[model samples]
Target chain A: MTDALQTDPRLLVLAQGDNIAVLKATIKAGEDILIAGNEVHVGSTLGLGHKLAVVAIQGGDDVVKYGFPIGFAVADIPLGAHVHVHNLASRYTTVEIME
Target chain B: MPEMMAWPRQDGRKGIRNVVLVAYLVECAHHVCKQIARPFDESDVQVIGFSGCFPSEYGQDMMTALCTHPNVGAVQLVSLGCENFKKSQLAESVRASGRPVNVVTIQEAGGTAAAVEAGRAWVAQTRAELQNLPMVAMQPSELVIGTICGGSDATSGITGNPAAGVAFDRLVSEGATCIFEETGELIGCEHVMAERAATDALRPAIVDTVAKAARYYADMGYGSFSNGNATGGLSTIEEKSLGAYAKSGQSQICGILRPAQRPATGGLYLLDVVPDGPPKHGFPNINDNAEIIELISCGAHAVIFVTGRGSVVGSAISPVLKVCANPETFTHMSGDMDVNAGRILDGGGQLHDVGTEIYEKLVALGAGARTASEALGHVEFVLTYKSQSPSNPACYPN
Candidate 1:
């Protein structure tokens, strides 16, 4: 929405030390985007509020956000890949929604 | 800081709303309670009931807390004459607080019809006394603030929640007691949350309660996390927890406050909503409002409710100030929300700006400004049976 935001991170980076960045707008696969001055290609189509791998994540490694481990990657997650339940897994079992 | 008109209580806690509470001791007495409150629908007189026929330690403690909640000016108890809901004890407590309390028993009052008549008359008399109670201007330090999230969406985590977190931080720094609850929902955030504990002793309680929540939900066959939460893009319980935990901002978590336990000091507190033992009666919270009631019982003067998908519910006594996160959802449910936290996503405003607005809105609401839900008379209430020992010593008031 401003020149500062565009040149800053290209997306919403919650913390400076965080690995994942939340998408401010939807992104399509193969689009080149500027992230904190680093040019990277979008690896997948992602929806808003979805997380994108701003850094390379190896299998069995913790995925950090909010400066803490929210979950771990089940497989290799490349830069610009959408991180979700498919590749990212919660260490705890997912629960049922009663209603 | 804005000045607030406070209704002083004998215990020195004070209140923002001079609400007349009509409480039903059992399911059977619910009808009489409803009938009495219906006539006064335009008034601040509200109805809350304990729906269990059997006795429970948690239920008893909850009832006592509700009767003595800071928002209450007077209490009216309706009993079926045969339940263990503790009408006498509640009345005795309110009466001791120097507030007018009227108890009507259905069996002695000649059934529902007669009890309703007596209850209505009692409400009329109590309402006058409630209005006549003296009001004084107070500062922010005298306030106890509570926050909760319902029905999250993607925008909620990134906008509404973070905004509320900012407000929590500001409120705590200003010397107000701030509380955030739902330990069951914070399963994955145990480590991160533990890092903010104010002391070494408090860290274990925070970790253990979250573990307790995880075990209880595991046995219940489902955690508090829902499909609605998933559609919001949260992949796991921990992810949702990080969002929920954000409402605490960066304040040091003083200690764990169980249901109906008030914080002893002015600081941020985490309410452990999970029942102490294995799950009993039903889910720990029947819905979001049940959890809201628990916060009220602990003496919250007002509640900051953040909703991303849009929730219209409000509390009976303590007004619920809603902060909506989704711009589209806010557009549709603008009438229900008090603050547009979605401005952050739209880039119209930042988190601190919205948080500052929430803090100011809280002060205005304390000055007798009605919230959207309160103006619409959306008084949603629920209380269920559960067993638990009293809160651990760390949680008691200073």
Candidate 2:
């Protein structure tokens, strides 16, 4: 990956205050990525279009994206960890994931 | 200053294309209607129909609106002769609209072969005269545009939806009529959306529309959220809604509209797509094409469709411009996409830059350009049973 792709907000983050950033490409476990001018280590392999926490989020904190709260974190999420159905939940409707 | 070359209608609305429409009044007549339009394929003789044999006011109204749609120059009504679809009344409405209308009863015409031959002959005769219909020039202010997103993902909100939003904003600024809809998917952004209502009367209506959608979904045991949405990294309906809501841009909500209802004077109107009262008709919309047909029924000349996971659908009457949001999806489906809003995610330009690209493209489409879906002949259409109360008078207070 090029340094420019890592630093571009278009490729990494959508808005300034969003706690989570979407992946434009897949990343392997233990790979390092940059977020808000800081280097963060990827904890798991996540595919393209998945999201990851850009900042440390405590349990029950609002997960922000597009400068609005999409939902809240269900557990204490460390920086660069995956923020998904297991770790995040909606405040309005139940997220039913079919097995 | 973009101008559209179009066919003028008696109702004072203008159509971007003058294509003949062959309509089936019931599912039983669908085959003959399809066969009738098949011979005129690729020349804009399109087919649309209602599948329900049982009588429905909603179904009748939708068929009437679609058959008399501005894009349609003439219509052929195919009926099975005993299906209670109100074929005569539908034909009268089309005739009243000052468009050529024909009715071919399969039972009366001696069978499928006879009916198809009769319908095809009328279509051929009608298609010949469409070229001579008086043409008119329409300004951007006279154009009605619509927006919807399907097969969406995380990249949708970040790139494609917002870019379409920007284009929506630009079009609204130029005095074009613009609409965005499906209140069922906008469950979480009610309060935020209400803040932009143009009138105080419209505020509560906005909130109530979303609340109705929430209640109906709760009763049905399913939200508009889907498994594909979940796999695409959308954790909840709220996340998907927040992204979906971005397609409206930042315009003040001018009014609320029901299916077959056009905006009185459009800035940006929210189409209340969820059914009123109960969840009797199952899901408010069966799929994305249903929503597209609703928009076309509301007088949109063309629609803006954004996607992240990727969709390749275009409606029967109006052109659907596909804006691909994910760079990878765009790479895989480049031939099906009209705008590469995904480039915004690849560090090509700002979201507004793509917004500008979408705006310019809509103008080109108005000036007689074919969208990717249009060029590929994707005239997919659907109109299912649905219920909507007439618009509240206060929702459109002057």
* Shift of residue B371 alpha carbon in model 2, Å: 1.6
What is the TM-score of each predicted model, taking all chains together? 0.93, 0.90
* Per-residue lDDT of model 1, residues B96-167, tens digit only: 987888899999999999999999998988787677777988788888989999977888778888889999
Query: Model 2: per-residue lDDT, tens digit, B103-205?
Result: 9999999999999999999989888888788788877778899999988776887789989999999889988889999788899989889999998989999
lDDT at residue B106 of model 1 (Cα atoms):
97
- In angstroms, give how far residue B49 of model 1 lies from its true place: 1.3
- The CAPRI classification for model 1 reads as medium
Task: Rate residue B306 of model 2 by lDDT.
Answer: 94
Residue B187 displacement (Å), model 2: 1.6
Badly placed stretches (over 4 Å) of model 1 are A1-10, A55-62, A72-79, A86-99, B224-231, B394-398
TM-score of chain A of each: 0.74, 0.80
Candidate 1 A-chain TM?
0.74
Q: Which number leads on lDDT?
A: 2
On TM-score, the leading prediction is 1
Q: Model 2 — TM-score against the truth?
A: 0.90
